[model samples]
Target chain A: MSELTVELAGVRFGYGAAPILDGVDLTLGAGEFSVLAGANGSGKSTLLKLLVGLLRPNAGTVRVLGGSPTDPDIRRHVGYAPQGLRMATSLPVSVTEVVAAGLAPSKGMLRRLDRKDWTRVTEAIEAVGLGDLSAECLFELSGGQQQRAILARALVGHPRLLLLDEPTTGIDQRLRPALVRELRHRADDGATVIAVSHDPDEFHEVCERILVLVDGRLQRITHEEFHHQFHEHGAPG
Target chain B: MSRLFIDFAIQAYLAGAAVGIAAPLIGCFLVQRRLSLIGDATGHLAFAGVAIGVAVGVAPIWGALLTALVGAVALEWLRAKGRLAGDVSLALIFYLGLALGLVVLSAHGGLTASSTGVLFGSIFTITWLDVWTIALLCALVVGAVALFYKELVAVALDEETARASGLPVDSLNVLLVVLTALLVAAGMRVVGLLLVAALLVIPVAAGARLAHSFRSAMLWAIAAGLTSTLAGLVVALLQGTIAPGGTIVLAAATVFAVAAVVGRRAARRHPRSSAA
Candidate 1:
């Protein structure tokens, strides 16, 4: 029973010949909440993906939940919400179905959702403020609303380890505090939450320390330092 | 309608009805995923497989299934590798499958009757066995679709998010392509290889236009597929010369055209929210 929820040492990764991440080392403990912020294409997304076991490092060890990331059990307990617009509006799925899919894999092959599953799905939808729109087609949603729906899907399973890349990109600033509180509650409920954001202030009260990426390297910085660099230096979007 | 009616017409009608429900049931997901061309690609490969099966004295449907599976895997692989876009893979597969089928057909002149059946299906030619084949396959296709319904929709919505959530994106994608292959191979007997994709796509597109939810979209698609088949079969029987394949595809297209108009009118009546 390792205390760390995520561990990566001497991690190296590249898409083709160009190195996207190299010589990186990181560790996160159980129930820890942390924020990773960096400029665009600064490997913030990559780190979140690694934690969720979505990508494998080329040259180093990546352990999630104290075991191989490729393990099915490890994958089942982890939830990930990727960055960017990941919806195909052409799909006819409703908000409920989209979030219900978070439970599909765990239900295993050839099984449909039961009463308990739907209950959880409803609760998750409500948490993201899309309870009224759960029956509406996802394509009918605004971008910010859609992003929150994705967040709800990620949190539906109450995963032991959760990773969100740029969770606030399309979200409204007014909704920021409630979203932070929601994530904080999940962390308080004994889950490790690692979020990637450009604005650390959104997560200042939730995270212990801010992790910054510079030239594919990881650096630990204080919240004050993060805000200063973020606002004054105008860290590239 | 009196003289055009044949003794074996019931089998053809039954087979068509089965495919009408099954093809569009799968097609709804395909159209949503924008992989509507997969049916055409698989149909072509199934043709090559059928030709080889005819030459070897085996069930042509089995041959078609094997070839379609291989082609589906190839399409999935090529699409995943980033070497080619999905439609590009579809085009490449259909061309190769047709080329392979032609070569095999040219080598066996005695197999003309069988090949003709696959290319331009005859409702009068359908036997009770053919109906059974269509029924069993249709049941399997529909069953698989229902069993993995959520997973399939999840992948179609967004592969990355689905994968991040621990759904087997690759496996589900493979299953979907193979199921598409199965539908096309089963449908080839009724709709013919050339028009199988049309049967898969048109009904689903029509359904998507009218539907407000996923379940409704699937139901509409199934209705469209069944209606097109029933209407097309009757028209073909009355016309006496036109194949059911052509008539069925045309009927589906007409349904789609009508749905397009209705959907547009409805959209105008209720404007979408200002967020695409």
Candidate 2:
């Protein structure tokens, strides 16, 4: 599609001899909010890593935003929040600093953040409801708060494509809706959002499509079918 | 018109001042990356370099710099390749340097008077030429850190995120180790090879205990470094018998002890600002 944000064609990948993803082909357009669901260790995170260029496929191509994901020019317009990723507590980096790091892709190296860039950092912090804790160390925050800060980092760039892995892992249930709504807003603003979640219902209101990984292949199913399959098979893998 | 000898202690102080400022500037990131021991490892490698230089009749500082640079680059390469665990590589480098230096020196002759100076540090033996050389290296280190502050912070904070964000993660990692090598070479004469890592790590610990952000931690670490170094040099000057290297490390340790206590109390008082 002319407005497609992601395209994967015959992609195959694995850690060693065993394969995780085999002959996978998919496409998603701009402004689409999608959920990737599978059992634990079913290659959902690996697939997201491929989209972000953190991991390369063993075969085939993964194109994001009209170019190879590994290209710096292309990556500048992509944002990713890895699963359960946390900075070392020994480091004294603050919330604002971590969120500001999100701008590095856009700014490149050797260029300092201007006043406007910092203001955007602050705006991202406030948007994630961490306005009061902007100056606090990231490790000092609760797990949920840290996840929110990470979300803010992913959101700060206003990227054309956003990939989040277990974005709601530590987020409070009461706050999950707000988090999903934020992702919804970003997708509505034309950013392609693909999130890996064990429970896709958490994103039921915002997600337009659900993709399940089973036998190293992607299967697209409707919400009703997904619910039936979930109850029938215990969980999709 | 010139005296037969100038105050070498004064020369040592001048050079120490540069080290005090630069070592901790590099230390902030090293400590953040949990590679504090890299300083110690590089220092030992520099010692081996210095020994080889002495054997070949080159300036020991240059030898130390060359060897340390090569060693830093090698360690980074190994770690980046993921063939060796980071700590294992560091340990191998550390012991290899120490043994290589000792064997080389023993083969030439037992530890000479100069070798002892390189080990324990001899402030009264510093030449004015050394002052200028150390100052130049420290300036270069400081300038590089300032220029790459944002990229360095992003990489040190979380490397995966930084790489995903399009930063040259591998290049930045190499830059950090190169800076560490340069610092070890610069400070070896003042802090001695055995204790140089103290300068790279202790002040950072003290600063991290009291500062809230990476920027402030660096400022505080630099402040602590200067205080320990200048004060230790003064104490050595007054005492006349103490080694400046040992005194400087002690001063830094004292600062860390006090900061730990004060930081604990402050954390109790303002639970949210403990990171500061």
Candidate 3:
């Protein structure tokens, strides 16, 4: 909890020519439960991607876990859940198969999961309340349940840092608190968590820190200030 | 059928069996990724490639492989750029391959009834070289899939998530297309260019209907592919006039129909989850 797990100095990035994150300097401490709130296309998701090493910075240095985010070894310790409902629902993949993929980078794709891996996968699934649906096909689950499946996938590897992009989008209203609690529990156990959300109210309930992405810069905002600003600007008049 | 008949068609039989396993195995990902038409698109390009080989006097399969690889590259380019939708790009290449094939076949003047077998597949003409080539190609596809199963599953399930997780998304995509080209090239022998897509797509479709898990679906797909190929070959041999490739496709279709019904019934019996 005392260690700096993420440090980005003068990081500049964009797609094609339109800049998204420009000269951004940021740092996150270990065991920090933080929410990144931003308008659509405000670089919130991009920041998470940059943290996970999915996008190489245009300029400046991005270090995750004291190594370049691009390093596979560094990324192996970073659990990331991307935004959007991208999982092909019609695809006949069981919940376990989805979670098992988190082990792929370490296990090398074709290797069968040993007992330990299976145990971790089961624990992760149960953590998200998907124990009963482990063998069920993805298309057989509701939208919220599917989101849990994706969460279980990210959690299966139990990385040192967790970066989730809108992890609550399709999640059930009832299960949302449990999901946050699980993440909170992980943070309490000394894992850094950085999550992106358009709606950060529920996230604020469990997270200790809240940062808003505005004008391509990370601005620290109090939990009360964030919800106030969100209502003022985000709500339709 | 006598043992002599079995012995004589052993090469074709072996090639067919390999297609039964390899085509559907690869097709599992292709179908899951919504790139199932890739087999047909590559097949069309293989058609043009084989025609060039036939007209130019090089090995037809080699020519098909070249064309298929070229098509795969084009597909990869289109996919990466996000410029053209997959099917549109495939359609563009499909027409080019089909038109080129027709022009080349007409200009070459070597297309007789037997030459028709080139497009329709003449398993009766399978050689030891053909069997070895198909076998070698199948082995590579299977081995690559086995070695990279997790990466492929990750990418296919969700490319962006897999990329974010540090999987080599671009290289894996290239690997997928290259493998598709190779399978299409090899599949041209047993099912011919016209019906090669059938073995690659239909089995996976049927498998999806029957299997609840990804592994089960792929296993079921292999079963469907193997049985259809075997039955089709046997029926085509017995019938004497039916095309082997077309007959195999029909057999796969029948299997898909049966699987759909059985799978639907099985699913109803469980009613396990409320997935939308």
Candidate 4:
């Protein structure tokens, strides 16, 4: 296994004239629980996209598992859950189908699924405590349940790195802790996890290190330092 | 009741109903995903194909099918590039196809009688061959959709999640675009290019107003499609001079209007109910 699961060496990205990430450097080693903290338009989401191979860096290099970010083989080792879940609300798909999509990168374009694929899918549903709801329509589930379903999808592929963009934003506050715990559990299992969030306090205990983005620039800090900064800034009473 | 008139009406109804049933089964997903314009665009592309086939002495159906497939690929490529929105791309492709079709018709020497037949579908002129073709195409479309239902649903709902889960989101999206093209080519003969989009969209829109679950929406859309096709055929036969395409679109629009009104009334009566 590579020492560094993901390495972004001085990456620069932008849309049109506005720069979203300006000469940002990042690295996630094997089995690290890293949190990306930033306000809106701070380029946190764009950085996640760079990690997952969805977007290429305008300058510098983005390497995932020692391969180009866009490589399907490299992507297979990365599990990504995007922010919004409203993209496919009208389709009548079950939870199982959604989770099973995680296996797609490994399955190739035209290959048929065998028994092993089914086992992975079943295990993924079970991991998220959604075994009972596997057959249920996704739209019928609560916001938290939907978030779990998305998590199951990211986990099913057993990727080396997990890239989640605001996985708990819409989830209830009660569920947020449990969700972070689940993510930490995955990291403990030797998977490099990088989660993007604005809620630094909620993730302080689980995230070993925090990377802050302010106006598209990057700053690395320890959890204690992040907490100290937050307290100094007057966190909510 | 005249026996000859009744027989003609029945045959026309069967032909129209076959395409109608297939269109909405495909349309429900398209409309839900905001890809409704793709259906309309492909239908017009098929029209241009038919015109080209007539001018070049090839089979019109085959020509229409090839052209629709090409248009589907073109649409997918444009979407992948992220240069334009799906609706904008669809509108551009559809108009380009129409312009090409007009050029082909003029090069072939103005408006011929065959051109008129293609524009305003001659339901009364439908042969047994046409019926068989529609049946086969419908069966194929239904079978393909059923076999890939799981993947299709996942892709249509949330493509990003689907891709993460390892579903071939791009391939599935391409398959859907190609399938829409195939359906349009098969249906162009029954409902002309100008009105083919109505067959695909109206029933789904109407059914969407009344359906609770995804399955129920598709079932209702299929039923609405069949009903409108049958009713339109009846009206077309009764009037004897009206185009079948116009009659069918009008009939579908009427069903959609009724469903919309009924849905709105039901929602007012029971605020918690899930209609529309």
Per-residue alpha-carbon lDDT of model 2 for B1-276, expressed as tens digits?
Answer: 122124776687688889999999999998888888878888999989988987888888899899989988887887789865757767887889989998888787746787987876766677888889899999999999989988898888888988887888999999999999999888878888888889999999999999788888889899999999988887777777778899999999998899889889998898883221
Q: Estimate each model's TM-score.
A: 0.94, 0.95, 0.90, 0.82
Give fnat for candidate 2.
0.59
Question: Would you list the C-alpha lDDT of every candidate in the order shown?
Answer: 0.82, 0.87, 0.84, 0.77
Candidate 1: misplaced stretches above 4 Å? A16-18, A228-237, B1-6, B83-89, B111-114, B274-276
Which candidate ranks first by lDDT, i.e. highest?
2
DockQ of each: 0.54, 0.53, 0.59, 0.24
lDDT for each residue of candidate 3 in A17-105, tens digit (9 for 90 to 100): 97898788878888888988877788888888888877788998989888888887787788888765686655589989999888777
Error of 4 at B92 (Å): 5.2
Q: Can you list the residue pairs that collide in candidate 1?
A: none
**Model 4 lDDT, residue B182, Cα:** 74
What would the per-residue lDDT of candidate 3 be over residues B32-93, giving only the tens digit for each residue?
88887777888888888887888989888899899999888788777788865746667887
Q: Is the docking of candidate 1 incorrect, acceptable, medium or high quality?
A: medium
- Candidate 3: misplaced stretches above 4 Å? A10-23, A39-41, A53-61, A109-111, A198-205, A224-237, B1-5, B83-86, B103-109
lDDT tens readout by residue for model 1, B1-276: 664455677777889999999999888778877777777888888889987987787788889888888888888777777765746656777788888888987787635665777876665687788888889988999999988888887787778777766777888889998888888878878988878888788898898888777888889889999999988999888887787889998999999999989998998998756342
Query: Looking at model 3 chain B, which ten-residue stretch has the lowest summed lDDT?
Result: B1-10
Docking class of 4: acceptable
lDDT for B229 in candidate 1 is: 94
Q: Give me the runs in candidate 2 sitting further than 4 Å from their true place.
A: B1-6, B86-88, B273-276
